[model samples]
Target chain A: MALNRKVGFFKGLKYKGGGPMWAWILHRLSGLAMVFFVGSHIIAGFLTQQFGSDVGIAINIVYENWIFQLVLFFLVIFHAVNGLRVTLLDLWPALLEYQRESIWLEWLVIIPLYVLILFTVLKSALGL
Target chain B: MQKITLKLFRYNPETDTKPHYDTFELEAEPTDRVLDLMEKVKGYHDGSLSFRRSCAHGVCGSCAMRINGQNMLACKTLVQDLKTSRITVEPILGLSVLKDMIVDMDPFFDSYKKVMPFFVNDEPKPAQERHQSIEDRERFDDTTKCILCGACTTSCPSFWSNDEYIGPAAIVNAHRFIFDSRDKGAAERLQILNDQFGVYRCRTIFNCTVACPREIQITQAIGEVKKAIATGSLD
Candidate 1:
């Protein structure tokens, strides 16, 4: 039953394509993720500020870990790319079809760039 | 005195197997309404055709249907004013077609109900008709002008995606009560509307404003809801 369900999920994913519907779903998902990250970042910043010049110490204590830094980096990149796409679509709805194509292009550009940034951050963090 | 053709969408989910368009040619008067032409076609041509209309002056808002690819009150659309001689009339978008021109409005009404469209104050009602200042009442006046026409909601892409979205019409209605000084449920209403699929779903699409027959600035009302959500104050 689990294998069948996993196959059904992949099949659903395979049928999806770039369109207004897809853009809307992506926008909502990205917005939710971005809001969550921003909230946590703000709260962490506040905690650090309250704790004094240990600001770097505060950040290091929580986010100096590789996993957290990687997650934050990916979240920022995803939010920025999705936000740019939404801004374009909102400004000129006539370009909606073209924007759908550009969204895929953005993923192509963003995924590799993010991976590179993540690699660099991880390497420097580990002093590799 | 131009002869025009109207392609009317005809279907009955119970009786008909599929939807199709039936065209009718009429020598139309310049001032004749689309509703008038529909009446003529129904009376003379096809007795099986069906649609909704009442208070032909546009106030009732029961006559809203798609004309020439736009949601409009058929009674308000003058046949002569349309640029094309051939026009297509269909049911409003983002709705289930009940029959030829009628749609199932239960979904629309359900969204309104989800927003808790009535006042919810724990206090007893005042004996003297809870007096609110003119300025306080006028704040919600524009939103109150909504006639539940579904034009604004259908025009909204967000409502198109998620039919359960308490749409602009409902949000505007909720705003009516939320901003009312006498109505003490502002916080409760705000909590209901602050969900993921609530007022935040609106992407500030001006289509609602363009389609509103009552000239209500729906985008502005949605913006006000956003502001209210942000400030934690409906007033």
Candidate 2:
């Protein structure tokens, strides 16, 4: 893919410093997002299981949509990567000095991982 | 018994272009306090030297200044125990320097006042002093030991970022009243500290614990505040 202005912008956001202050801010943001999204996900799943065949129609209406799938995909990826970062920092005080570097690296790693996951989702969605 | 060298930061807002360090060589005794050395430097070496001290003891907590880059009570630190040929002293960090070894304490006290560091009891005080069980009183005893010293506050990194954090010293004081069974304003005080800049800002660095001259467990008090908030039991 050609590197466009949009890609450059996303890269800039991804590479921003993850110092202790930044880590704390991101940790809170990711945690809140995880709590809200995962809570809704569990509720929807439980409703689907309870309603059985009628719920398959509701599930198809929701899951067949690309926008909702993409949002959910990004949410899961963000929560996973940021959650791991928070866990590492909490467990290892010695890694504090390299927090900024590690944050940039996390974005570098997560972007590719998310891209692969997104590719898989699109393949399955289009039946390609 | 040995001669010691003191490197003291000197700045006079009224006259000096910028702050500078002045080194003084002095003969020291085993039991001599850091305050004693400062007094000697002011009276004999340079009469214009300025710093705050009262009671010549640790109780007043006014003599808190940076000794060898660490916040400590000048009156309580013994010269002989330092075991160093050279020592450096400066005013407390994260405060406006008023002059050499003197800082503006209004900001620190302002945080204390914001927390409303006073008792508010709905129950009328008994004609005899309000009686309390030893366990209940002990909860606040450590916090009450704070003598308004800037040591703990200055040592905290969170206070450096947010001047409004009510620092360790002030928060400990507020906790003293908040945890008291007789106090009625616990919820109000907790509300003031529940903001992004308040107790949540504390990263539990424990610098305040090491800096306290009275050996007050400042971090523990902050932890208790966290517990109170988490349990929704500030009342």
Candidate 3:
């Protein structure tokens, strides 16, 4: 049988679930955000170092902005901590039986780090 | 006995352009199954309504559907377990529905066959039966409980998004033979499973594990296969 497009990408979200599905969705989105952010950051660095300064200047203005930095901070921390939880679960499949427990643990690890990063970025951004 | 309103999904692709739910009011004992509820509606209320069941004891895997927003064996789920005045019955997701409640399972079986779900032993026959250690049997024992029910596969998130991803059930079926000490078919099966649409496509959503009627630790089985293939170790 062919693919049923009626069951679209948000099929999982359509169902009420515990923490794992939401964690998976967030992990994917955060990972994607990191990929775009790093790709641009690397591209901007190379451009500034080699070609004209126009691309670099534009990227620097965005990078120096506190909102951009805070977004980057959120994305990086979320991706890393969730990635660690996923990796640990992968390495030990037995841990997956505790999917609910691990998700809370991932959040516990993520939130405090996220808050600390947020405050630091806020301090730096506000210049206070 | 209690009066329950069963809101069931109704669709005939040949006649209707879209799927819709048909509600049936029926009397049922608290101990009666969801399948029994459907039977009351079909026998007394309507005949054109469609569904499938055989053993009615849950072994046949024929009556698997979403009952009360969960993938479960209709015959295996009692009315009281749902605890709702209105029982919402729907076909399993990510599969084409053929009629009122039955889903087309041909594509689901196609993926099962892709795993070469039989023993492949080209070796010379021994005088005795093929031997397997207790430990080796224990390794893949969890996967052997699969009844070929589409519950786990239909419930998989990867199968929902990408229909070609070989789903969790097939991977679990493959895991049955991959770790069998007597079987010499791991390499060939691993090739198909290692494809881009293979086992790697599973994002560990764990829906299959939750939906499985046999209570197979499906995600763990999938992980064991992935770990085995990557390290070239069959432990």
Candidate 4:
């Protein structure tokens, strides 16, 4: 039965999907962030070669900022850890039933590592 | 008994320009099932309120709808389990909604059909019946629990994006037979699942796994199907 009452895009996002859903959304966002970062990195390199070294240096200053590094670190670490969780579940279907627990475990690995990353980044940023 | 506000997503093609929520405040026990609340609404409040329910238990899968925010069988989901007095009921996401809490399941079933859900054994029928080792039977045991509820499929992001993606329920069904030791149709089913709109479309998002009222490990089953496609071995 064809009906015009399809789920609107934003409405679909509002569903009470649990942790796995959030994981998926974050994974997608982190992946896109990585892609954007890589593209910008390449563009910065190109600008340095074509325009001048000053343009690249300016971009590097922004990138090397502590806030930017923390955000980038978060995106990279979350993406990798979540991707690993997905891969592990994919490889072992038996763990599928523990999908929720796996997400928690993913966070277990992410939290301390992220804290350490934060400590390192902040220490370096502050020249401590 | 607590008075709870039940908000249902209602749509009528003939009467309404767009879908709207109809809220009914009802006295209900926390122990009462969402289906019981729906029954009260249909019985006392609105006769025209449309939904599908059969085997009031979870077996039929007819009562599957979005309860609060998660896809669940209303009969199986008690109000106490929700922990919130304000309950929001809507049709499962992704599929075209036909009316109040009912969606066009044809597309869902069409995907199911593409998976060749039935057993295909070209081999002659055995003397008594085709025998299967316990381990062989156990290989597909999880997927066999699927009640063909569109819950898993409709909840899937891939299925939401593209209906032709042959959603998780179908893959679970395909996995049912693909791993069957007695079934001779794994090759054909695998070929069907290897299409562009097939196993590769799955992004390993566990929405299907969570949405499954039958508690089938849907993402795992899809992963198994993908692995089967990759390895070319059902073993």
Candidate 5:
């Protein structure tokens, strides 16, 4: 198209905000968190294997911690299920018609799973 | 008469390096349309101000602009609808702005044209009128209301990022034909929309649906198109 002015670089991007946008943004953040967790995990594994007693104890401490286990569980579940949602979107673009309901459904499924994990971690943490 | 604040975007590409907002205090009734306020500004307040309007009603879709950060037909939005005395108006995004509130629409229209938005029939023309059932015509009735207003497309973030994506307006027009029972070009149109740069580019953000002046459910239509692409079924 003919132009009287170039589209504003900093300001032109303003658009209405909605569910899919937030879902995509959250997915990226969750992926980044997983990347960090995985990176530290690999390093811990390598250190534990080579350093023997000292690093092995440290790795076990973190591995057995209930708080650490809970967070790890939450992040993995969120990333995996949300990733599946993304895949469904890519393969069948029409799924967007139900995007709102799908998002609510994702929460419905994730929340019970979260609570179940919560109890499992508690049982192990307290040794009850 | 009550005084209302009109914060209009002002930019002159010829002279000004930085675009800024120009606020006009005017006498207006709470029921006056936003376009009415603008007309008053241009008619008596300052003749140098420029914006496009025809029909002075919502039918032409010429007065669409961003009011309070939402794209809507200026004629359709009432002063009281804003619920505030201060109003902020600017040109729609996803298109190059020419001046004050006018935007370069060639890119928008070109995307619509690329969809090949017309009926096609391979068989010889019927000597008599081609007949259609009410059900067949009802399938695409929602899309026929589109007036080529840039509201839906311009409000889309993907369209803002990539003008080549064949925004929602084009897709809506394509839906009008693709679902028409008498049209023989559904395959061709579907092929065009199935391209990586086509319908799949829509992120289903629903901004287009919200911004459409005709109240057309734009995202829903786009989803229907996507279903047709995936299942090989238009139902």
Candidate 6:
């Protein structure tokens, strides 16, 4: 009862949770990233209103950076696809046996779409 | 016989301030079970080595421990299965270790008890028996294989973060009764599992499914429980 010690994050990482564990971790990380992005976006909008066009332009520069855009796009796409995978499996328990395949399917869907996004972002960043 | 190095976790509440590993070089057949290696070390090398073993055949689930980074029944895992001469054995994670390779199972069992693991049917008894169809029997057959080894629960990251989560084993047990046609406690069990600390804590990580020595489809079972709670339909 009193002896319960929380497993350290790195120690828990050592335990082989396999593909699903990675998926769970990614899903959580992406979800958090999206929340932070939205919160910062709202704050940026407020700053733009109070601090004038200079602050708005500075914030736009960071947001418009291709590297940040690529990472943000990845977080959004992965979170959506993985959330769909988890939701689909939760809705249909019989599909649970194909969980590994579902994870594969999620990657299959994410890769092509992410690649296209990467190409578009890279072209714009390079002025190509 | 092949040369193997057995690394065991050592700890004593009375003496050692922290746990440490003790290594023993011993020769054993590749076919020998990990439990056999532990026995040899305890019987010959050091009598101070401590671990739990009962039945020595994986039936009682007493010998469940982390073998080569995976939760497995030592009696059921062979030396050859490890594909290496070096073996590292430790207690399953999440619960507090009472000694070396032996954790306090009371916390694990407390979660099990919270799920109402026993059959509860307040309906009047039938003349001979409460008849169940073969189809109905198969509904909960997978979850019935749980030996309460604490492998699945301890392997869960959710449980490692918070012991109050009730982990996956309790959800599996809840699924067993939730789907039972003969049991009238489905509604009660569903209500119990509907909490945030209940079924929702499971992140669909599949660690419980992998850690289960019985090869139960633990994640599928938990999914079923979640569905039952959401729909309020045991079907």
- Chain A TM-score per candidate? 0.61, 0.60, 0.83, 0.90, 0.75, 0.90
> For every model shown, what is its TM-score relative to the native structure?
0.65, 0.66, 0.85, 0.94, 0.81, 0.92
Quote the positional error of residue A49 for candidate 1 in Å: 42
lDDT of 1 by residue, B1-235 (tens): 8898989988877767777889999878889999999999989999888899999888888988878866788999998778778978887766777788888777789889887888777788777777879998888888888888888887666676677678888888888888888788888888888998888888754567667888887766777777788778655
lDDT of 5 at B82: 88
On a 0 to 100 scale, what is the lDDT of residue B121 in model 6? 93
Candidate 6 C-alpha lDDT tens digits along B1-235: 9999999988888788888899999999999999999999999999988899989988899998988888999999999999999999988998888888888888888888998988899888888988899999999999989888889999999899888998888888888888888888888888888887999998888999988999999999999988888887777
Which of the numbered candidates is closest to the native, going by highest DockQ? 4
Model 4, native contacts kept:
0.62
| TM-score result, candidate 1 | 0.65
Give the poorly placed runs of model 4, Cα more than 4 Å off. Answer: A1-8, A53-58
Candidate 5: where is the Cα deviation over 4 Å?
Answer: A1-14, A18-24, A31-128
Query: Candidate 4 on A1-128: residue-level lDDT in tens?
Result: 33563566787788767778888999999999999888878888888888887878688788878999899999999999999988888887667778888888999999999999999998988988
- Model 2 residue B13 distance off true place after TM-score fit, in angstroms: 1.3
Query: What residue runs in model 1 are displaced by over 4 Å at the alpha carbon?
Result: A1-128
Query: What local lDDT does model 3 show for residue B75?
Result: 93
Interface Cα RMSD in Å, per prediction: 12.3, 17.1, 3.1, 2.5, 4.1, 2.4
Clashes of each: 0, 0, 0, 0, 0, 0
Pull out the clashing pairs in model 6: none
Chain B TM-score by candidate, in order shown: 0.94, 0.96, 0.97, 0.98, 0.97, 0.98
Regions of model 2 farther than 4 Å from truth: A1-128
**RMSD list, candidates in order:** 12.9, 14.2, 3.5, 1.9, 4.3, 2.2
**Position B46, candidate 1: lDDT:** 93
Q: Ranking by lDDT, best first?
A: 6, 4, 3, 5, 2, 1
Model 1, A1-128: lDDT tens digits are 00010112232223222253355455666678767766766767776677655654565576657788787677677768877866665444334435446668778878998989978987998888
Kindly list the per-residue Cα lDDT of model 3 for residues B67-109, writing each as its tens digit: 8767899999998988887899888887877787877888789
Candidate 4 lDDT, B1-235, residue by residue in tens? 9999999989887788778999999999989999999999999999899999999989988988998878899999999999989999998887777888888788888888998899898877778988888998999998889898788888888877877888888898999988989888999999999999999999888888778888777888888888888888876
TM-score winner, 1 or 3: 3
DockQ of each: 0.03, 0.02, 0.33, 0.57, 0.30, 0.55
Judged by DockQ cut-offs, the docking class of candidate 1 is: incorrect
